[model samples]
Target chain A: MRAIFPAYLLALIIALAPTSVLATDDVEGAYRLGGGYALGDTGLRLGGYASTEIDVPRTAPWHFSLSDLSLFLTWDNGSRLHFFSELEAGDLLSAGEDESLGVQNVHFEFERCYLDTLVNNNLTVRVGKFLSPIGQWNIIHAAPLVWTTSRPVATENLFSTHATGLMLHGSVNVAQHLLEYSVYGDASETFEAHRSNNPFENAFGAHVRYYLTDSLQLGATYANFVLNDLQPIRYNLAGLDLAWSYQRYELSSEIVYRTTHHTTVENTWQGFIQGVAPISQQWFVIGRYEYFGQTQADAGQIGLLGLAYRPLPPVILKLEYRLGEHNEVLAPDGLSASFAILF
Target chain B: MRLRLVYPMLLILCLAGFPAWAAEPLAVVTAPDYPLSSLSLDDLKLIYLRKSQMDAEGKRWIPLNLPATDPLRRDFSRALFSLLPEEQEEYWNIQYFNGISPPKVMASEEAILRFVASTNGAIGYVRKQKVDPRVKVLLLITPFPPN
Candidate 1:
């Protein structure tokens, strides 16, 4: 029932698009006639990006894996009303036997849909489903927006990826430095979109970042999680992050510590120093060496040394060798190739 | 006898040193009134290659780059990156993943000169001979100069 609703709504939008474009004066930056035939303007913005990658495991035979193909639709009806959304379908062309009784699995899943009010650009609150403001990666988290399509291992596991709830965020300039802050409260029943049946827990988190210069930043965040899943567990976590980048070289790191059972202090650290050089205008070379380790525990160690080329601003291709120690079972050593673009 | 002979050779080597590496034309100039000044090896890397967004006097500053294949561009790259053939790749790839775009490239010294001259708040490097009245020279760096 839920899957059919968006399809019907998308159909409705398609039918109404002609009327919207016929009523517009001209095609501009964010608003234009779809295929030069629709009357669309005054409040709609359309943009989308896609990515695909193939990996060869250390021991298994080579195979093709398609991870992502997505579309974005957003609207900002001037000041107080807005909507942003994405529909993504991943892992389309994998060679595997179907496990589920009878489903081809080709449907668009809504990753984000939110309505925001702009209280003067700098301060505002949003309600709906959106990327969590818990850590750095979640804010500019799209694949094309980031240098590497895959995020740091720590970024994937520790930070909350998305949430359904309310978030209050604001920014200010203090003594010439820019500072941005966010606080969010989410209901645990809305965990992982697909697994949202239980409704007995709630979580809250806050993050603050200070931009020191055009190429450097300092940020810190603290979050406490409480759950009521039969046996409740409470976690107190804090993190400190710093980054410096210039030209084709950059250095960055993050440290996260959490306390559980009221006294045990466990910490994990991740960082990397990388450099990018242009071999030619059409062909640029990239190299990176990164490491993240856990203290007092064998937090999995992952390092990627790779190179990439850009055919144009909208297209990028790369080859990388990824090696992980400590998690021998997950990913031993592998070579991967990927392509991504946004339009 | 040996000391006297070695003395002239040492003096000659010093004189031939940097000027040979970075010789400048006698009367070349540049363009673009102000976005950049007193550019060092570090500043060049930060401004041009990094594509860093900066604000000065309410004017947005943008740095441009020469074509990767241009000779003068090779000289500028050597001076700025200071890396051998193998290290430059690793040097730049690290920055790519850091969410920074490399500088946009133009065809020639004339293209660079024309671009900096026409665009507001633009900065670039070119040959001293190519410098003209259309732009402003912010810094003068050469292998050697008459002191």
Candidate 2:
């Protein structure tokens, strides 16, 4: 714990040293600084501007509090390396499930750490832990960076926010169209479970993306991941996504159909349509509608609405509300507000 | 008819003298066979921008630009990218910062000629008279006559 402070500070200095003095500083001028804060952790749950539950009616408790601080540094070339590590100090004093999730564990994890290098010319290779480049949206997964607080159910079914491994990503120009492609080989030591935010055993996946246009993208991914020593379920995900972004307004949708080797389990599918419209240059309104069918026994739909304020190019502050429903134990519905920063 | 012969002959002689007054414009050098066929303005934009690679016949089109400061480079950008000199700088700067390197640029017209002559799909432009058996011209960039 003591080591992290000095190391982080040193990194900050090294990264911030004005490179303009150097002649090759074409990329030295582009760097961003950002972080987030929340006020409550009790029933007043909110992450950033995650969602508004009342408008849509979700019965679950909101997860909000003072948590998740980050700093992002980028460069002039689209190639970027972002180190997003969150320190949840709120739970430090909390005991456990008994007192409150204690911060004593001081759980430290890297949201992203990668070096994006464009090889020779066209090919780009990303090494280290980074967002899985499975789809257009997953690569830029951040609460503050996004218009909506809650991502669609499709994202949940398709891939995770971060993946650790080497990603080969680049674009090729065909006859008249541009074909953007990415092939990733992930080798993360551990994986997070989907439900309950539980820690699962080690997991890994292979992902790919093909862009039909500047805005529209088609993707397919496969994960031969294991969970809790259960027979490794061969998870297969095929998805179609259409996204268009302009200066002020943007819309993106992802529809994924998931199938596994287990025949007893029902094939599942989910989708989401997310839209953001700028009210002004600095402020915007965002909304997302998500639906998923877990199995014959359970399925639900969710809606999210939020407002975002960007004071600068790379810094974003958002306030959001989300409403979603499920079939059983935890409650028929849930909502959460979250604040996330992107580098 | 007999009386008008002298006036008609003088008019013909006057018309014949005009060619001496206006020198013929410099001709462009391009590939003779393929002739850069089927590429629209947008297609050319895509090719030059490195979004499109293969030429119409599937030969990897090595679209070469002159070095940044070269006159030929400016001429190509002005004609194709449709950008003024300042705009071209900004346009390439954004792309450069976006992690995209510009197309390969040769040092001089002779360097382009040598390289294009050696490589099968290589492409470059030069004066019409500079053309020879060593290379093939694919297209032309004629200058607009001054008003």
The C-alpha TM-scores of every prediction are 0.58, 0.53
In candidate 2 the C-alpha lDDT for residue A154 amounts to 66
What tens-digit string does per-residue lDDT give for candidate 1 at A42-105?
A: 4444555667776676766554545566666655322244456666776554542223322244
DockQ of 1: 0.03
Q: Report the C-alpha lDDT of model 1 over B30-107, residue by residue, as the tens digit.
A: 344654544544444545543323433433344565555555655566555553223354334333322222454566
Worst 10 residues of 2 chain A by lDDT: A38-47
Q: Clashes per prediction?
A: 24, 25
Among these predictions, the greatest TM-score belongs to: 1
Question: Candidate 1 chain A — worst ten consecutive residues by lDDT sum?
Answer: A30-39
DockQ list for all candidates? 0.03, 0.04
State in Å the error of residue B61, model 2: 20
Q: What proportion of the true contacts does each candidate reproduce?
A: 0.00, 0.02
Query: Against the true chain A, what TM-score does chain A of candidate 1 give?
Result: 0.76
State the iRMSD of every prediction, in order shown.
12.2, 11.4
The DockQ leader among the candidates is 2
